[model samples]
Target: MWMGEGFVSEIQHNRGREDTMDDVGHRYLRELVQRCMVLVGKMGSLGKIKTCRMHDLMRDFCVSKAQEENFLHINNILSLKLCEVQNNKVRRLAVILESDENYIEGVKFNEYPYLSYRVCCKLELGNLNYLQTLVNVRPKTIQIPTWFKFNLLQVLKVRNKKGAQDAIQMLISRCPLIEKLHLYGHLKKLPEAHQFSPNLAKLTLSGTKLEEDPMETLKKLPNLKILCFRQAFEKISKYESVGRASFNGKNMVCSKGGFPLLQYLFLGTLYYLEEWRVEEGAMPSLCRLEIEFCSRLKMIPDGLRFIATLQELKIIDMPKPFIDSLNEGGPDFDKVKHVHSLVLKSFCQRMIIVSS
Candidate 1:
């Protein structure tokens, strides 16, 4: 259990569903802490709790309750003994590994279920059928099991170590109900628009290299609400392309009506990005925009002014000139003056504002 900040509420809103924590998400978590049912963990820069851990007693209590209610099963892959009786009636299974020596050698998955693997183990997935959620901790590529069915899968988070773009695309193509996907590691190329998941709501690409303009393809994701690129998107040239030679005069443009439902966008550590253009009507629903460590980027997209729904804009560790241009009476001030909250941060200082 963890303090979701606004993440939980945001997910509910993005899915067009009422928030389960509508009236008291934080209050509920706070009450749990007050009752000693949960232990608080990490805190964010804002001094708000970001994560929460459970005490051993609380954990045991939860596990017992879950088993009694037929809510879920927690399996320890590393400590399983022949004397233990596995519960086959549980519909949700969370597999955890206690050590590197443990392997997924004999886990059965014939029932329609939700499976979460909390370890970086190399396991064959062909025998699993009717899985709803899967989180593979390892970045290694595994062959798709022949008995695997993707139609029922809704959430997938995995890392591809071999830069297997094709393999990822093939998996995505088969999952019609897929909603959230997080892909980590190098990706030489992204899949074409036709192969995109129609219901995909959130997407994250971390530590990947895009051979072409990522926006050109990502913009077509009809229901995408959250888009993030972390240390992703690098310049590829036949020769060394750093500094002046890297993306010398390149630009990325977001076309009109693109990312129709996007609410948040984050671009970080894009070392070679020098220019980004946003066309009017693009990201019409965008509520927050953040750019970080993109030293070469010189300006904020002028078209951002047209996004009436935008409420926040943040620039961190960017070039000094870029931040200066967003200051009051600066060249681009008028373009972003309408945003309710604007924050600009340089190496040693930060400026925050609330528009009139």
Candidate 2:
């Protein structure tokens, strides 16, 4: 919230000549400035004004009256300004820099002695009651608050170098109804045979690996519509006894019932593509598929038999035979009358057109 001297001069200039200022004129102008600040701060806390406006207004007020305001005066007014925030606190609350840092510097927790209001240094999402989506990139480790139980959470993204994966599992376990989840580098091992939310629609697991196959976790998600595995590098030792590591083979992706409602699928540079068990009835509703940088793929399994409604298929940086299998299948061509576009790229580019 740093303001240059030029800004102060501009405000004074806008206030007009000192000679023209009667007692009423000075009083009204000062009151007007204070009134605007109070209204803006209140509106910000009430979630009426955009967050940016609140930050801007606070910055301007602070800069305009630096000499007149002290730490206590500023802190008291800002606290009163923020008291208007009602219940159902926003999960994605962005604490702008203009927010009262003195007030932010006052939250306290007794148990975590190492991380008091002082160690925390800033108040990001401490006092919020309904925060479900939180991703802060400060030097702090996000520990899930105990009060946070099953709520109406649908999306979560968190990144911390330490305890990254554990945090993700904790959130997933807590929010059983979460519909979409994206994790970037947080999760050492997938949950050990736990039931996932049946309402899960989209999942993105990036930048992590596991000693065990994570297919069982996917099996728990009955309503999963979109699945993405991006840059998830697994240890070579994890696949020692595994058969050919390719979803493109005679026997790949196999499950009890398969992806019953899955529609979109993306597998990116995943070293252990062999873990996918292209089970029968899996991907019954699959429509879009993209496989990129899966060098280990030998062939796409014939078990992908029931993708009857597939519309778009994309294969990149895979073996020759894998591409051949897809070309031979013609995209369950009998049922996928809606599928008119296909893209295959390797050393060259080829586009195919299909019609009903």
Candidate 3:
């Protein structure tokens, strides 16, 4: 999330070596921890911080220092003092209301139907160019009534919409620069190839019903690098077809020349995925893959053995039989033997981490 907002973009620059946005973000966090400004809360098995926080004193002190120095400046001129300004041309607007610590009883949340967060607002994006994040209620919470000519809208996430595919397809047409899109609605159809933004690097969809082979369309995205599907499909075993919708069918295929720039892929909650076939040359740049809650997936794709670029694989909450197939001398062992990091999480909360 910090990476998408350009928070640490200037922290690590041309220092003579390749530095990814992930490395920069982590390094910035480390600096804060070293200075006692932030505290690490939870750490992942991969040594990454999953959660963190800052002391109230530290936060207060930082705010005081920033305000004293007039630090919230854009292009080194316009100061962002938010609430104090009467003018409405600062690009992005987020309303944050701070109240007393006393708790109020029996206060109906329905009383404030106009409230929206990321700092509760009486929401309206009336052509005020800079778009950050607008999280609201159902599908009707946001409406792009007028065409956006100039916007800083890089990321968007919406939920509970019936026509998610069409809505997003129309969105990308107006804000053609959106790089990261996360859809939480139930989709009846996946968007076509030409409907995507050429600059898109990450795509995530959850709880969608597929009518066609999604990979057939997703692979055509020119710059997509990260893809995640969470509870995106449900199982219907009686009516099965090979090479059809992955959830409705027993088999799915990843043909050659697909996902050319993709590097990270995650599939979770796919209950009936039994087989995934990857033809050679598919996802050639893929480095990380994670699969969780896919209880019926019996084996790893044989084509993955040919993807030398794959460096890490993580499987979680899978059936014992599925986990056993990746053991030494097992049928699927040879396919993933070349991966540098292999992590398997069991139902008992036991995790096996292997680095080869």
Candidate 4:
């Protein structure tokens, strides 16, 4: 999200540097952690912070300062009217929706789990050419203007856009610099992966019941580095959505040359995934892998056994039989023996099998 907003992305790092925008973003985050601006909420397989939380005092101060400077704005449609934004100029905006307009005005902030505050927005996004990040805006609320040209937008997030496939595609086409996209809604169709922004590096989708195999399509994305899917392919009743927990299986195959610069992969809560194949050279730069609650997956892919770059593997909420198979001398044990750190988590127990 920081990268998309050009927070750390546009930094003219060292001349002729090889670091990616995503790498620069992480390096900035690490600096924040060192400064104690936020607290780590969750950790990934490779010990990177997957989520973070800010203290109430810090959060409020930042929000107040940002709004005062017109540097950031929060358009909470439930209580605050869109037309009432302090200033017309904002570099980044977060559009929050709450169907019920009546609510307690908490001293700090309120959380509205239900969405949809529509049509009254009237804010012309087409005029906000300086905008860099537009997050959590519902298509039903603010229709993307036909003349929209957000050349500086780098991060876009949309929620509960049930039937706005064409509008979503059109909106994406207008944001030439968009790099991170997150879609959360029950979607029946998906835009062609090839049509995605070529500069896109991070993508996340949730609750999308795509009729087409998403992997087969997404594998075509040229610059994708980080990908995540939650409850998109798995049986909804068997597994609930886990934020930022990436892949949920649906007949996925990692073909050769797919996600060439990818470093992190995650699979979670896929109930019927019985097999997964990874061809040689697929995700060749992958360093961290995580598989969680994929109850029916029978064995680890044979290709993992040969991915010399793989560094960490974490398995969570898996069946006992699956855990046994990765133990010493077990059928699939050798496949993961080379991993530097191997950890597994079950409902009642957590254990580390190996560490380097």
Q: For each predicted model, how many residue pairs clash, with residues at least 3 apart or on different chains?
A: 1, 19, 0, 1
Give candidate 2's error at residue 294 in angstroms: 0.5
Question: 1-356 in candidate 2: lDDT tens per residue?
Answer: 01111212222334575431223333444464577653332331112232222357686766557535422122343343343323323211223444445325433322210121223454444344434344332224445466665454545554434355545566567666666666555356665435456677777777654444555557567777887777633344965532222122221344657667778888777655553446557677878878776767655544454556777877786665555555536543333334556665653435432332
Residue 65 lDDT (model 3): 82
Question: What's model 4's TM-score?
Answer: 0.67
| Overall local distance difference test of candidate 4 | 0.69
Q: Top TM-score: which candidate number?
A: 1
Clash pairs, candidate 4, are: 229-246
Top-lDDT structure, candidate number? 1
By TM-score rank, best first, the candidates go 1, 4, 3, 2
The per-residue C-alpha lDDT of model 3 at residue 341 equals 89
Query: Could you estimate the TM-score for every candidate?
Result: 0.71, 0.54, 0.67, 0.67
Rate residue 189 of model 1 by lDDT. Answer: 72
Give the residue spans of candidate 2 off by over 4 A: 1-127, 136-140, 144-147, 160-165, 192-195, 232-252, 274-277, 328-340, 347-356
RMSD of each: 7.9, 15.3, 9.3, 7.4
- Write the residue-wise lDDT of candidate 3 on 53-155 in tens digits: 8899987887678657765323211333534333433323333334642222221121111223432223344453645443333444445466553245556
In model 1, residue pairs whose N, Cα or C atoms come closer than 3 Å (at least 3 residues apart or on different chains), thus clashing, are: 126-145
Write the number of the candidate with greater lDDT, choosing between 3 and 4. Answer: 4
* Tens digits of per-residue lDDT for model 1, 65-115: 989998776877655542333454444666667766544554544443455
